[model samples]
Target: MYRKIFIDDENAAHRELSIYRKGHVNAIRLNDEGYFVYQSLPISAHNYAALFHYNSIDALNALPFISETKNGLDSWDEAYLPNTLLEKLIGILGDELDAHRETKPEEIMLGWQDSPEKISYWRVISPTEFCSFLESLMAFVKEAQTTGYDLEFIL
Candidate 1:
């Protein structure tokens, strides 16, 4: 699945470009739609706390209805398995394996961060739609290698 994090609105590309001018974070165009995509080594360390740094419960609740899949529920705590895209995504990603096994009996906070100065977010997407989105995104990237793009999640 394509993984991503949301930081904030960048009003001017040139202004935001300065953040990466020093090469601390590698920059890649998400697609061709002009949305910035910052490439970082996929989060694996940091003790799983990074996952909670970018997810927002309010944002999640505002998303569209996502069909619950058996696979998505298998990895989530029973309390979280009722119905929701988060549960579905967890079920799909954790299939045959524990997605949040350590957090049993409780819901896991999948990466998000909040602050008065700035807001940042991260999300784990289901592999099921990863390929299709990649293909579509590839087509966009091929069209405009220099332009950035945004990948919107449809649940």
Candidate 2:
């Protein structure tokens, strides 16, 4: 579901647009020598901001998303592609999807637009929609695994 919110920040009145942050989860198929071969349409992390803790550094660091490293660097810190990550991702997405299915919780995205921005914007992710996203992500991960490809989360 789409939601709109009013903000009182006077600084953004005349600005055209200012998107602070963006994230994308994509499944990539690479050739030998690590050359890019293919990439799936990204599943944006914009709606799932809570999962990444938004701007709360402490809470964000605690997430497993930062623990999974590729070549000794945080996986989420860079576009590090680790082939084994999808298996873990499936379990996480599966559990989250199931939770939404069972409890039917309503989640809203809290972003800069919700505070003070030129545009009045926000999102109310309904249970069904969130579940759909989880399902799509799970399916995407499964397909990537089956194809022997790796996933990359660009945040």
> Which model scores highest in TM-score?
2
Query: For residue 64, what is the lDDT in candidate 1?
Result: 44
TM agreement with the true structure for every prediction: 0.19, 0.57
- Among all windows of ten consecutive residues in candidate 2, which has the lowest summed lDDT? 53-62
Give the per-residue lDDT digits (tens) of candidate 1, residues 19-112.
2111111234333466454432122212122222223222233334222442221112111211223333333333322323333232223333
Q: What is the C-alpha RMSD of each candidate to the true structure, in Å?
A: 18.1, 7.2
* Cα error of candidate 2 at position 82, Å: 2.0
Residue 42, model 1: Cα distance from true site in angstroms = 20
Q: How close is candidate 1 to the true structure, as a TM-score?
A: 0.19
lDDT of each residue in 7-99, candidate 2, tens digit only: 222435422334223355666653457656455544343434434432222222333443234322222344544566667667767667665
Runs with alpha carbons beyond 4 Å of true place in candidate 1: 1-109, 112-124, 146-155
How much is the lDDT of residue 145 in candidate 1?
30
